[model samples]
Target: MTETPTATKEKPAHRSGLAAATREFVLIVVGALIVSSILRAFVGQMFIIPSESMQNTLLVGDRVVVEKLTDVERGDVVVFEDPGGWLGQEESGQKRGSVGRFFEVVGLLPDSSHGHLIKRLIGMPGDKVACCDAKGRLMVNGKPLDETSYLYPGDAPSAMDFQVTVPAGHVFVMGDHRSESGDSRVHLSDTGPNGGSPGDAAFVPLDKVTGRAILVVWPANRFDKLEIPDTFKDVPAAAAPPPDKPSISLTPPPK
Candidate 1:
């Protein structure tokens, strides 16, 4: 009997070791979650392309990294919250439950099903944006935008003609696949149910922009850094129009 006891004497020690290992693993997982949450809340986040709106530049299903702190400039691809129901529905039509949405908020999952939208920032505040010059190019503050570098093949700059002055503190955005995309041009006439102004419904406020999309990260083969097109560099600064001179109305001399 004494000899048999020797074989089982170390069982408690083995059990203790296993328990310690499990505890360590749980701690590691919790730590990782905390780090991920912090990074996503304040630094950057991953978003998936949900439509062909930005096609040829970003395909559907492509995951992109959006930098939260970067300066958004003209021609930068940006992700923004839907302003005043601007985005009616998602192309994929995917829905997420509350649990899944929680994970997305914590950076544990990609928010592909959310109502956010991605588009190229075409006009900055106070810029005049118009469609179709003589050569069928978009005009930004009197400069013709050469969009061939990123526009979908054989796609026109815009099929629908429009002209708008981007109001202060707002931006005008458009998609590369102009014909298929319902971007700023599509919302130009949306006055909302409350009879809000046109620009109020169409323009995206600066505060609504989440971040600038800077990289394509999904599918491995499609990985690439997004860069501003050379055409944006050639765009001239928007010149300020002269202030209207105060009209001097001549009052009838005591008629």
Candidate 2:
């Protein structure tokens, strides 16, 4: 007698093309967002320019990438939080709907330049910074800074007089549009006894500096890398403080 034919099990059904495609799309989107978020949170972030403070170099609508990977240097453009009451008014007037806000949050759009200030790092801790010498230029650590390369046309180094020495762990910053920027100069009790003042309002603590503006990525025509001007690189370190004189009275001063 012939043996009974063996029974065969049916293969499992394959997933529909549309269903598979949708699942893959969702996964790709999720993965892309994760990478973007990581890059934005630690490597770099994007910010929109809100004012003319950094004009000529940065436009009002320009988008810039601020990198957190390096130490800030004098002459580097930095984005920092409002040191106390620096931002008098909301610089950003962006009115976004739910979708816009969502996109910004997920790193798909640039952040509003709100609650932040961007300026050129001019004076490091202990560096004596002053404005308007005989020829009318900024003096940093006794060296005149020739700012013609980026200073807005027809503007003076500073219309106001200020002399300050950046205090320890702080920096003095100013906008390229000196006339329009309400920078360290605006908060000076006098510009310390005001470097005691980024000791006061104008001097920004290193902690407040979120990142250095590394590149302009928007307004295709305006894209460029931000570099430390040669003038800043050539600035000499602050002179050493003079030693105190010995006491003339009977007892020596306590150490």
Candidate 3:
């Protein structure tokens, strides 16, 4: 009867409920950030193409999706850390703001457009990679590659002529726009012959590879899949060195 006697304070209970909800929201946000960070560190991340090194394949300002789940393969477009002096003088000084850095750490922003280089995997460990033949084509493992499908509109396979067997645990890379790219070709300290490939900073170490660029996600017009062209399908395996470490053939084993 004294029923509505003393009205218990409803404010405290409502305040407690709001506080609990806020905590849950915060935790969810934090947990999401953590998952994104882990994925970026070990699974996949976004990278912004800073230069036209990749050209029509990847233009300036294009956002590329680099995945770390699979092994690097020949014909795969890859993004890697600067092996040494690969970056130009202007690239060394680029930096992101604190806000951008935070986003980068959480996988919301692209990797620093500076420290990474993207190129096609032209040679695998111990594979011989060389320039144009009589028909003006690139050669891999003694077979010719008709690169017309991916090469920039007017770019040649390569203006320079050289051959190098990729050293063990290293890979040889080049840009689609051969003329504009300062790839492994220009960085060679010495050439490789008879399986004696010069590795002195000429090749990119396996550990230095960030991941393969599999997709272009931004600038809707440029949206596309970065796939191994049909040319690689016909590429034969590289012959392993006799009495030496065997090199892995990048082409798929014949079924």
TM-score of each: 0.84, 0.81, 0.86
Give one digit per residue, the lDDT tens place, for model 3 in 1-255. 466768665667788999999999999999999999999999999988888778889888888899999999999999998887688954332569999889998998888766888999998886877765677788988888988888988988877677667777888899998888988877775433323434456688889999999999999988999999999888787787421332323332222
Q: What residue runs in model 1 are displaced by over 4 Å at the alpha carbon?
A: 1-11, 192-195, 241-255
Best by lDDT: 3
- What are the lDDT scores of the predictions, listed in order? 0.79, 0.78, 0.80
Instruction: Compare the candidates by TM-score and give the number of the best one.
Output: 3
Question: Per-residue lDDT of 94-165 in model 2, one digit per residue for the tens?
Answer: 646789866766788887866788999998777777876777788887788999998988888888776766
Model 3 misplacement above 4 A: 1-11, 90-93, 190-199, 242-255
Give the distance in Å from residue 130's predicted Cα in candidate 1 to where it truly belongs.
1.3
After superposition, which runs of candidate 2 have C-alpha atoms over 4 Å from their true positions? Answer: 1-17, 93-98, 190-199, 240-255
The positional error of residue 41 in candidate 3, measured at the CA in angstroms, is: 1.0
Query: Pairs clashing in candidate 2?
Result: 192-195, 194-197, 196-199, 197-200, 198-203
Per-residue error for 2 in candidate 2, Å, reads 19
In candidate 3, where is summed lDDT lowest over 10 consecutive residues?
246-255
lDDT of 1 by residue, 1-255 (tens): 355554545568879999999999999988988998898877889998888899999998899999898779999999998777666565543668899877887898887747788999998877777776777788887888889899999899988777777777778899998877888888776764456654456778889899899999888999999988888887777676411211111121111
